[model samples]
Target chain A: MNVFVVGVGLIGGSFALDLKELNSNVIIHGIDINESHLQEAMELGVIDQKSSYENLSLADVVVISIPVNAANEVVPRVLDAVHEDAVVIDTGSTKAPLCELLVNHPKRRNFLAAHPIAGTEFSGPSAAHVGLYAGKTNIICEVEKTAFKLQERALKIFSDIGMRIRYMDPKSHDRHIAYVSHLSHISSFMLGKTVIEKERNERDIFDMAGSGFESTVRLAKSSPAMWTPIFQQNKENVLETLDEYISNLLLFKSYLEKDDFQAIFSAMESTNKIKEILNGIVVKPI
Target chain B: MNVFVVGVGLIGGSFALDLKELNSNVIIHGIDINESHLQEAMELGVIDQKSSYENLSLADVVVISIPVNAANEVVPRVLDAVHEDAVVIDTGSTKAPLCELLVNHPKRRNFLAAHPIAGTEFSGPSAAHVGLYAGKTNIICEVEKTAFKLQERALKIFSDIGMRIRYMDPKSHDRHIAYVSHLSHISSFMLGKTVIEKERNERDIFDMAGSGFESTVRLAKSSPAMWTPIFQQNKENVLETLDEYISNLLLFKSYLEKDDFQAIFSAMESTNKIKEILNGIVVKPI
Candidate 1:
């Protein structure tokens, strides 16, 4: 099978690595606007050949793993270029806009919208590695819109890469992901911003950052080029989550202001239930 | 050396383990209000014997690793019970109030106010480990107030456990910790609270919590009993940090509201500097 991967960065490069490991017969062709990333992916053997959208017709599968803003413009173009029998899948963080753009297209049945819920704080082809998607959750949105055979192929590929599939509407996927994933990145970035702004001495922060601070602020290291588009594309849901998060912070601040130790304790204690839920997210060791 | 450790929970129990490893000739005596913890500490060999305040005078060194609220009351009593040569070190998170309480005591020279910037989200004796303090930072506040011999003894013990010591005044310790440590806990707890409140289905949260979410909210699982007192004692500094943090959140929200992608990108880009600083915190493998 020939796989044409658009935007061959972290997600696409990782998928390429895992796909080849699953089936040696699989040949991955890379396409990216960035010439260096395409060269790196080829040098790293993430792809067997470099190809353009004009040659996408040769692919048995086309995976779009670009930034959401670029994905909105490119998904239709990829569908237009792929063969009728080829299955096109997108691995974008936000799904609603991409799904809406292709909902009524003639070749819509060939495209599947997927959000593979996995990644590291780092980005680019260099950060890509096999097993990134292993034992992770993948959300398939608007699955009913895809043809049966294409959906089956998508599921089989995900399973081969060790991902468990969950089905939901694109809107639902965006809404929930805003709270679970997107908001975390924003909060973490702002945390780093706040600390850096307030604590001028970088050495002091370095000296005092325990595992807790390191863990809490890890997401701040994420690529701005990749994330800015995500926040922009998922603006409404992200804003809603931010409002709730900000309000919670303010309420917590008020408790501190009133010296309401009991309220503060109760809030944290209630959130401790997250441990039980988090323990269930079994990430395969890298 | 006779070492007496009060409140044999995570910090105290781990200290006992590391202290024993560093000096096999040292004897650790455990005391706790909870009988179960006392018994468990002895059974785990975190302590060689059980002792009360009545026998504290026999201790050449006393380590008080209790919650900050309790330390306010118990630190003075521990000082009163110890001999002139004995050094009493309280490993509380906050330092200002505790230092104030012992400022004019006749045995002030015998007490050293220290905050070992080390801990995990989990608590209790079972969480204790031998290398918990290895490659960690220990902040000794008001070092000038401690007698020369006692200060040297405290530094030697911290160094033996593989911690680098930094000296700061009590007020500076409290202020800096509010930004670097306490603020992180609040942000993480509130993030957990916000998500749990919005995402009603526990299964959805469990399914979607990737490494990013897990890392960002890890501190939400910390012991409420332990953290509440620290926040209360450092109310002024914590409140000030919270205000600055909230204002930063609001500013970021404004950028999101206006669809200012450049501003959002730049904000996160600037905070990416934290990655460089965080890389310097070398956590030892236990």
Candidate 2:
């Protein structure tokens, strides 16, 4: 099977690696605007051959994993190039913009909007590894809009590689993801910002940090190139999550100011339910 | 050597476990108002005997690892009970209040205000483990107040168990830790609260959460009983950190509102320095 992995970075490269490891017949063709990433992907064995949009016609399955803005712009072109039987999957964090952009496209049936909820903070092909998506939830938006046969083939492949797919509409997907995924990145980034700002005054402040600080700020290390477009496309939903999050933090600060230890303790104790909720999803080491 | 571990839980129990493992001659006597913890600590072999305050005179070393509020109230009593030769080390998160409380105690020369910057979110005797302090930083406060002989005996044992100590004044330790440790717990607990509040409307929101959310929210699972008192004792410093942190969050929210992706991107880029800062510390699994 011919697998075309565009972007040739973390998500695309890891998917290709897992596909290749699972199916020996799969040949991955790497396509990235950045020649260096393509070169690195090939050297890492993340792809078998470096290819481009011109060769996308040979693709049995085309995986587009780029910045969300780029995916919004390039996915229609990818759908136009692939055969009617071929499935083009774009793994972008936001779904609404791309889905809306592709709504009137001729080959909308061939395009699948998938946001695989899995990743480490690192980026690029060197950061790619097999089993990145194993036991992780893959949110598939507007699956019914895609051809049933294409959905079956794509879902089978995802399931084979250890991903469990949950179907939802693009609108719900964007709004929900703004909370669980995008807001997490924002919270982490801001937490990092607050501490970095304080570091100017306190030279050894970081020395006092422990595992708690490390875990909370881990996502601040994510690739801004990829995340910038996400925050842009989903700006409205992202803004809403940030507002709610900031207000919640303000409430906590008020509790602290008033010396209401009971309220503070209750708030944390209730949130402790996240432990039970988190148990439902397996957490990989950050 | 006889070591009395008061309020034997995660910190106290782990210290005893490490002390016993490192110095086989040491016998740990567990003391807690909660007798079940003492029974469990004995079962876990975290302590050799279940004893109380009356037996503290026999202690060569006394570790007070209870909550901060409890530490402030009980530490002076522990110091009064222990012999001048017995070093009493309080491993509470906040240092200033307890140090101030023991400032005029005649046995102050035997008291060491230590805040070992090592822990996992889980609590209780079962969470106790050997090597919990290996490769972790321990911040000691008001070191000079303790006699040189007692300091040497305590620091040597901590070093033998693979802990690196950095001395800071009690006020600076409380303030810096508020920025690094206390604020981290607040951010996590509030993030968990924001998401859980939304969960009332969105049942499957957590399904979309990936390792990012898991890592950012990990500390929300920490013991509220342990944290409440820390916040109570360090109210002023914790409140200051929270104000700075909330302002930063609001600034990010404003950038998101105004469509300033560049500012947002630059903020995160600068904060990405936390990756380097965090690299200096070995992060244990949350």
Go through the candidates in order and give each one's DockQ.
0.83, 0.83
Q: Model 2, which residues run further than 4 Å from truth?
A: A283-286, B283-286
Tell me the whole-model lDDT of each prediction, alpha carbons only: 0.90, 0.88
TM-score of model 1 relative to the true fold?
0.97
Best candidate, DockQ-wise? 1
Residue B151 Cα positional deviation in candidate 1, in Å, after optimal superposition: 1.7
Total clashes, candidate 2?
Answer: 0
Best by lDDT: 1
Which digits, one per residue and each the tens of the lDDT, describe model 2 over residues B156-235?
98888788889999998888888888888988988888888987676667888888999999999999999999899889
For residues B147-192, could you state the per-residue lDDT of candidate 1 as single tens digits? 9999999888888888988888899889888988999999999999
Q: What would the per-residue lDDT of candidate 1 be over residues A1-286, giving only the tens digit for each residue?
A: 9999998888999999999999989999999999999999999888889999889989889988888999988989989898888999999999999899898899999999999998779888887898889889999998999999989988999998889888988898888899989999999998988889887754664687788999999999998988999999899999999999999999998898888889998999999998888888858742
Residue B112 Cα positional deviation in candidate 2, in Å, after optimal superposition:
0.6
